[model samples]
Target: MVLPGVYAPQEDTELLAGALSDEPLPPGAAVLDVGTGTGALALEAARRGGRVTAVDVSWRAVCAARLNATRAGLPLRVRRGNLFDPVRGESFDLILTNPPYVPAPDGTRPRGPARSWDAGHDGRLVLDRICREGPELLRPGGVLLVVQSALSDPDRTLGLLRTAGLKAAVIRRRRIDFGPVLRGREHWLRHRGLLSATDDKEELVVVRAELPV
Candidate 1:
């Protein structure tokens, strides 16, 4: 369940969850869920027997996650802070994220509900940061699973992870109809040449990156 201001579990969440369900994680593996909204992904990892830690910058999200974990009887370490900050110096065997990838005009990060989806122009603000910093928080042989819209450039994500020495590839993809945010920005996307005038759907991609042992 999602609280006000917390990101609700939607299509992207289901896609990431499906990918997570297919993965084979070691017993008692350490898992971190960055930008975990309502603890959905973290709970999924925990359900698979991973010792889960969830982080979010929004207090409401943190509370919602904690409550969900309690109701579900899962042991989740929920932290309220920016991505990875609350778990500095910690390494996880697996990391999962469904970060904001919606392209917006302003580079200024939003503090309201928009923070859940309004990524900067090109939608690489959070994506780039995750690609750059996530490797440091992974153990050798650790895996990072991230979901993003194709409009945000999955190729760049793969390239960035590969540059960071991880073998990355798109493990899963699903085409979904445009939501309110995309609908609102459809004209802008068309004007920017990122989307065709007739495009009403976007492909969501799940990227799996594995650090070498």
Candidate 2:
């Protein structure tokens, strides 16, 4: 399901088809998928019986997701806009994002159409913005799921969620070797005591947090 300008969805994005445990999504759910590169999560939710709004800042991604949805004969509302702007004033029972979380050099915007895959400087540009906006975009009792690399600051992400008034939790984790850029950012995060050895080397995490009902 690789789309225009996007090389492909990452392995972790495919793993989301399991929905954290091969569990079925509750019927009639309203889901929003941010950075819907290959629309994997959005399409998966549709298959599980939820209505979905799939959004990507990249126009290519939006068109591709729409095509993917149409090809599957699935009904999905695909739109193009940055972050949560396109879906403003809307809330979802489930929100999923595989945001760009790569840490680029200071004052640099990493070049790539892996728009859904590249996290900006310090791995927080898109991730931080997402966390800060989650409480407003999610309905009570809704869940927000994220699959991100250890290259990003999980603790910081958790803090951002909590500060936004959500009950955050880490529901899953895995290890994937960091890329050269991420490998370098690890030093800064580790020096700040953000990266943990307990999670194992090159560990990445998929977190789930619930908004209070």
Candidate 3:
């Protein structure tokens, strides 16, 4: 169950889940789900025999994930901390994240429920961190899967991952209509030239980066 203030599983969550299902998981492979909200992805990994650990900065999210895991009868370790903080010194066979990528007008960091999607002006605040530090937390031949919006510039994500010595590319793309947040910010986005005047949909992409063995 999704707790109050915790992000609920949406299209981005399903997109990542689909990609995870296609990935061949070795028996008892170590998996890390960063920013795991309801633990949906973590549960999926556990169901596939992965030793899954999920992390989120929100206490509510951590509690929700733990409760969801217990209810699903899946083995999952849930922790509350910023990305990678709780999992330091632990490398993973696969890492998954669906971080906040919506560009916000304010440059300051977001708080409360907005933290789930109100990224900074360029929508790269959290994305950049994951691109930079996520590779270091990967085992040999480990894969990193990230879901983001087209408006956030997937090319930048690709370049950052490649620069970090990973083979990165967009593996999945889906066009979805704006949600409440984007709908409300449509005018501002258009004014900022991030969105077209007539466009009401945003393309979400799943970028897969893999480190060489």
Candidate 4:
């Protein structure tokens, strides 16, 4: 299955795999992997003895993830629907996601292909939604693992999470240069119509936030 428009699953898969491989999992834990691109993270959880359900809005992504999970000798539930749509009336001990959070060209216009990558005009479209909706999905002491480029506003994202009643914090950071993606970024910022782009040294932040509210 060819998942077009969706950003390719590379770093997220690698990060998720590494995280899951580090230790033995708690018994019979349930996990929710949103925007599970290649089903790699979902598989990682399953491989670690977690009962995982992965959902993607892209049918192609869903098909590919299902196939990948099968090939890896891991059983996973793959659903094709918008974020949080496939699983309703459900809660999990963990939720993992690598959402599209590239801030758009303007504060109003999406900059690039976004079948899966465009978070919103502010680049927090999927992210904020997750924060707003995540509380309901967690199992009291549940955790949410999110990874995103620094272009996405970490402060705002964390604030939103806490406001939504969850305690959020950064778990990891990597200084990644976005010169490739933000080509002409300076020019974009110079525009009178848009807000100035924030200069961040960190390329990405991998966060693990716990829910208490």
Alpha-carbon runs more than 4 Å astray in model 3: none
State which candidate has the highest TM-score.
3
lDDT of each: 0.93, 0.76, 0.95, 0.73
State how far residue 64 of model 1 sits from its true place (Å).
Answer: 0.2
Error of 3 at 199 (Å): 1.5
Off by over 4 Å in 4: 1-6, 16-24, 106-113, 184-186, 189-202
Off by over 4 Å in 1: none
**On residues 7-94, what C-alpha lDDT tens digit does candidate 2 reach at each position?**
4765567655555445446888889998888787888889888989998877778888888898999999998898899989999999
What are the runs in model 2 whose C-alpha is more than 4 Å off?
20-24, 178-201
Q: What is the lDDT ranking, best to worst?
A: 3, 1, 2, 4
Leading candidate by lDDT: 3
Clashes of each: 0, 4, 0, 1
Model 4 per-residue lDDT tens digits across residues 95-207: 88888776666555353345465555567878888888877899888888888766677887788888877888877676644444555454553353333446533367776
Residue-level lDDT tens digits of model 1 in 151-211: 9999999999999999999999999998998888888899998898788799999999999
Better of 1 and 3 by TM-score: 3
Local error of candidate 3 at 177, Å?
0.8
State the TM-score for model 2: 0.85
TM-scores for candidates 1 onward, in order: 0.98, 0.85, 0.99, 0.83
